[model samples]
Target: SGALTRVKTRFYHSGVLSHCVRVLSLSPSRLRGIWASAATLAHLTSSCCVGAEPGSRSEAFHRLFLPSVVDVLLSLAGQLMSRSEAPPLLRTVMDAVGWLLSAHPHLTAQVLSSAHYEQIQMSDDVTRSETHHTTSCLPEDFLSQLNDESALLLLNDAVAQLALSSDAAVGGASIRLMSDSQRSFDVSAGLDSLLEKDWRGRGFEQEVDQLIAMPRPFRLSRRRRRSHS
Candidate 1:
């Protein structure tokens, strides 16, 4: 029998966080990787967290996956915020981002307010209405929708009071957020109120299930779950 790979519990190894960044740069099919990584990231940042500084993990995430996917997620955020419904995959991404930002708070600015973020500018106001178009005219929606990175930054500055809400796993397809008694990758910020009900599509469940279906204990292994943190 092949040797089992030990999953790292305390800290991520050299390539883990960077790997997530690479996967995110691929097609939407790679969403599962993002989900798994997000969950692990959350778990690592929890009280039983990586042996790092008070909040350096935020920079780690910024340097790893945020740069690659922030453009897409932020742009996607505009469209989702305007509509009454959202794709499950997109919702998962937002959930994951909120998890990370809520955990670090500092990452919220590093990501949602970056110079690159300023350049993309996902919006619906008359100024950006030409290209992005106004998804909704509801003053609240327009107001809450951060076109220039203001929406999420409020959380970092304690200006925005985002209630810590969570959605039950959409499908039994993704990786569990927690590996032990602590928790998987939860940040407590409820981003669900913004997006409507979940779509029927699978979250990160199927991949995990597929893996689980394979050889039981042998297929699973452990290590210090390396990270960019």
Candidate 2:
């Protein structure tokens, strides 16, 4: 009886769904298997219905895929965050987070709102650990350019863009570094000094003089009256 067999399969799937929810809810570590199972199911279902006509069943299958896909993406994000070599792979992870965010708002909100704070804090701890092991870590070229104020401004701008645009993959340590850099902003000190040197007798000087010659808004009323005859 084809109808009887279909009814049995439906009951089996329903039972599996209940078990999956229980596992996902109770144990955080249990999430690793969730992605594997969800992926397998999606693959199987997609293959089975490839030739089936478009109808209610296809719509239901797609609706079910949404939550399962979100779960897998979120779990993967958390797993990557815990890895030791995050820096070397940071760009790759950021791209993944951006991709996930575009497709899954619920997952994006969960990561961006609550999970990101802890993720960043842990990354800061890792960076600090690395710094303690080395006396002088930066390259010689970086050290040489460090004294040039313009170079520092350029470096700050580059890091700032990475911090603002990067998603879950960028982690907390990278963001903390950016924040620390922002707090240390001193245009008068580093790159600012270089800009001042280059701009000494250039158009910058002429622009400054022009600005000085310009009347203040308060003086505009008097200038208007004088010009009116």
Candidate 3:
């Protein structure tokens, strides 16, 4: 009776509960009650449409549930990238994405390439700050507004900044995340050089050395002060 009531309640309110449960699932083992609740919610969601005839009901279930599931999964990923650095949770989120990729490759790609995902990756503050400002335009539209040379220069600048970061944790994590995103999206252009072991070796120290070694340009001034007679 209790179990059926729980299932009925979860099934009826699957949308918000799914996300809540998914987030709760990321919690540590000491929170076993929360973990169990998440597991129960997952089971309820999975079983909600069972025994439905192969027709409109099943299709409707998919149409309603799939998007919500994708949203929750992507939200988990964003959380992992922005909020949490716990290795266990990170591994769990990675595994979830990997599994989702196998089952829904296109959807996974869409989620990964979403402007929201990019925003989360670009700045932790955007994720953390409630009042964070973001443009209404799509990431593609924003990028499209940049000319080819501007786009290339922007990309180069981002890469250089990440590669040359003075903080080891920040630089390493940013580069790894970028490389992972590129690999996931099947793009391997500029990342090859970045992924090299010696990349960080050519960071701030090297830039400083080059700057110090370069000679300053001398400019000849044309105007001369008139001599007093």
Error at 225, model 1, angstroms:
46
Each model's RMSD to truth, in Å? 18.7, 17.1, 16.1
Give the range of the ten consecutive residues with the poorest summed lDDT in model 3.
128-137
Q: Global lDDT of each model?
A: 0.33, 0.36, 0.39
| lDDT, candidate 1, 13-66, per-residue tens | 444544444444454354433544543333333222222332445565446534
TM-score (C-alpha, index-matched) for candidate 2? 0.27
lDDT-sorted candidate list, best first = 3, 2, 1
Model 3 alpha-carbon drift over 4 Å, by segment: 1-55, 61-64, 80-85, 123-229
Candidate number of the best TM-score:
3
Per-prediction TM-score: 0.32, 0.27, 0.35
Worst 10 residues of 1 by lDDT: 172-181
* The best candidate in terms of lDDT: 3
Question: Can you give the lDDT of residue 178 in candidate 3?
Answer: 32
